[model samples]
Target: MAEFYHSVTLIEEKCVGCTNCIKRCPTEAIRIRGGKAVIASERCIDCGECIRICPHHAKRARHTHLSRLSDFTYKIALPAPALYGQFNNLDDIDYVLNGLKQMGFDDVFEVSRAAELVSEATRKLMVSGKIKRPVISSACPAVVRLIRVRFPDLCDHVLPLKSPMETAAAMAKQEAAERTGLPPEQIGCFFLTPCPAKVTDIKMPLGIEKSQVDGAIAISEVFPELSQKMDHLETVETIANSGVIGVSWATSGGESAALLNEKYLAADGIENVIRVLEEIEDERIGELEFIELNACAGGCVGGVLCVENPYVAKARIQRLRKYLPVSQNHLMGGPIPELMGWEAGLEFSNALTLSADLKQAMQMMVDIDSMEEELPGLDCGACGAPTCRAFAEDVIRGGCEKTDCIFIYRKQMQKVADTISKLDGLKQFSKEEKKD
Candidate 1:
């Protein structure tokens, strides 16, 4: 099993105690306390929505500094498709690839190439008899983790395939190592990431045991230098082989459009996807074959770490799409035979069943119900948890004292009133001094 790590953390000093993130959090993982925000690890999906919303720039994504590349004998850059939309008038893709090489990389590998391979794999899954009616895309690691942690029953539907980024890293490293006659560790395969989720995926992979990616640098952190190079440099003609469909994977509905499967329904942004998932759970979306959910609003291009504005980035992607080769009609034939049965089974440490026992979980639910009955349902988040129900869970888990609940405070006040009423005879003797 993959030992997943979420080292891409929110710096508490940078946070400004904003409720914007609290509202955007899909898992309701963040809570404000002591004039600061805190992230609950068990509940965080690492979707990067908080990173995108913080106004004071308190939210920052940690990535490998360019200085670290000097230690490696040969460095390879794997730019995600979202990186392509970061620059204006980037007339040629080679400008981006060559620019990375100039920025200290020995070579640049297009992540879109891996997308090509993934596209082939996706097509094969559709044709294969093993897959059920709708095979969910495993491209978004955050979505995959969300399913594993929050919606364990829906895990089986995730297509058993590595993401384009991982596939690109695997292939690029293998080929680069073979050519350079160096070990895998010597050749660092760094991804130019679009969001914190990808950073988390690289550090602590989801469905796979060990991720092929070595490290990632957020696009927003690297865009300044990359954009400068594109401004004045002459473009070189490179293999533009990553199919059109593969390039499309950077957008919200790119996967569905690439697969061109009619039964599929792709929804972008975390909250929107959750709403759809709820409908699915309620059995309202039974007719749909496949569902694609992207936590980022405009997909990877509108990710938290991109330099270009969301609308501009999306428009560039659309324009960039016209120049690429079509994936469906490509001459690459079909997926390799090995890819047909490729299965990356569930990657988890402990049993994916609820963390608490069924009895305990039910009791927690009951406690939450009682707390809601007693307290106001304003969702003020004043008690440190995002909601009153969450506060109740904290009490049940022994993380909080019951007296801290607002409703309990009110009840205690009532008890004090009753005690004072019983002491009314003693209060009459004290009133004479007050009148004088």
Candidate 2:
């Protein structure tokens, strides 16, 4: 089995074996077993859909706390554009940045500033015609990981660029080291993340051997301290640099719009993202030159770790963008920088494969098919697995028994009762004949 590490986990005590999570999961990475939810780490993208759907608040993202900043000699905060949306009636991004600095960060870096640079690089890459089209954005770690596992055909189409968060961390560390005369190791660049996917990305990166980010802290977790600081601030620092194009990335259609290309498609929400990928894989969406997909409904603003409602946050982001310039960062005229691109190429993961051995896999497929035929074809998720087909696979893999399905159990019980009735009738007829 391939090793799997994830930031999303189940609180077994709080889990009521509710089928809500399993059904909402795009990768079917969750299952209810032993009356608790279990995550298949290899399949999980840490999209936090389960975290969003769980009524009992059983699923949650494990992220670095503010205390972790004490470990570093010089701490830097790389706040996502989504963080700006969390503030109420916030007109300036500098307040959010200064608030983070007041809340213990030695310095603050805007991920949106890095996002603008990424956007410029993407436009240049698109012009070079060196990659496949409609090129998909690799900005969302959840979407990138989703493509790696579920949409292998679209692997080559993924833009070979590190996410803006990673880029911001790299830039923050470099600047901090130069200004403070500190070693790179001493400068901890932490992302104020809007999602668990970035937390997992920092822990187990996709296209890189290692992550540039030192830690991932949830925006929701930082909201209280930051809000308190913002409320008490006498003067807001002139910290905001990036503009409309960069900050717009907080909501849906932001990145694609930044490309300044009309022949592009953008989709938000996990289900819609899946549908778009399916169509692209089938070569149906041919007109567009670029594609941007966010796993959350309203982009990063919709992330589970965000405090404000997604729509409200999205509107705040729009209002926040109105006063900003078109864009603040731009790439120098030349080839793209190596540091900006992914160190490695995207590859398909065999985590979803039935078996390693071809013959064993073939036989397992046959067994799964046979078992599926016996199943009630319900994707109801009542059998602990996500779907009847998944339940069948569990039966074939010896993970569970056929009777685990309520429908199958009921059918067996009914058969046993019918057999007893027939036997009793036979006994009564024999007794009657003897008496005659």
Candidate 3:
């Protein structure tokens, strides 16, 4: 098995082997082994569920530091719209944008602007009726990975458009290179991400060959500095690019609402998204034109990296939206003409593929079914697997033994004791016959 890069990593020393993460993980990607939580890299979607649920704070998001900004000649900050919700009594977004410049970014570009473009593009795509019903949002990398791993059948329904972060990075890099008369390599575009999944997306992007963004910095890592700067700053640059529709992308139903179409559905939280995907798989949601899914509850505001309570953040975002001008005009008149088509380069990750050989895989499935029947069906994590079915799969994959399950071990021990008792009785009967 090849090792893949993961944004969410465990600090083993801090782990208490608590089952909080195991239960919260939407994909069941975590297991307790040797008194530590172990993340199955292939199974993980970097949704940050473990990071949020862990009491010990053992899970951390791996992201670029502010010091990395010094490496590039020009630095562009691509701040997510969710950043606005992190602060209290923040009336102006300009303060936050300007604060990025004080923190070493040469220029700041709002990802919300790119979101406007994506919104327009999606609406146009929806209008064309070229895509499958209930076209899934590609903005949430975690959701996309979940589909790839658990719902491969619905992979085609995932909208092929690039995420706002990616689009903004690409656009910023191009614009920076042109304006500065410097090569693209000299211009670094760093995304101010609200979640670990976005960091992973930058490191290992889907749909695109290479990420335009040079790196990702967690919003939590920069919040303190930004807040301080905002508190004392006398003058701030204007953030005029993004409108209400774009900035609203930070919360649940934002994208769908931006489309101005009633047929779209927006689902937030990975569990809810999973339920919606299952419905799509069952052909129950064919009437919908689009579906926006975010891995975090309350959308990006509920991201593990975010500091504010999701409900509070969502309220702030709604308040901010009320102040911004609303226009019927589509921003950027849809995505750039070059990026309008489906992403033919993208393919399903297929992380859940049992085996390469169909016949062998079928046999393994049969074996798993047989093994499951013998299990207690408690779905306990004592054996380090989330469910009895999962335990059976683990046994089939040689990751565990039937004896590892306490119930199975007890049954085997009882059988051995019965055999020994029967042998003793036979020996006693034979001895009695000899005496007679």
Best by lDDT: 2
Q: Write the per-residue lDDT of candidate 1 for residues 360-387, one digit (tens) a residue.
A: 7677677767866776777776676777
lDDT score at residue 75, model 3, on the 0-100 scale: 96
Candidates ranked by lDDT: 2, 3, 1
Candidate 3: stretches off by over 4 Å: 1-3, 327-336, 339-345, 429-436
Alpha-carbon local distance difference test for all models: 0.75, 0.92, 0.86
Task: Write one digit per residue (lDDT tens) for candidate 3, span 1-436.
Answer: 2357899999999998876788788887888888888999989999998888888999999999989998899999999989998877666778889888888888999998888888888888878877777888888999999988898888888888888888888888888888999999899999988999998888787887678889899898999998887777778778557778888999989888988899889999988998999999999997788899999999999898888899999999988877677633354543446653335644666566778899999999999999999999988778877788888998998987889888999999999999999999999999999999
Clashes found in each candidate (C-alpha, N, C closer than 3 A):
1, 0, 0
TM-score of each: 0.89, 0.96, 0.95
Lowest lDDT 10-mer window, candidate 1? 347-356
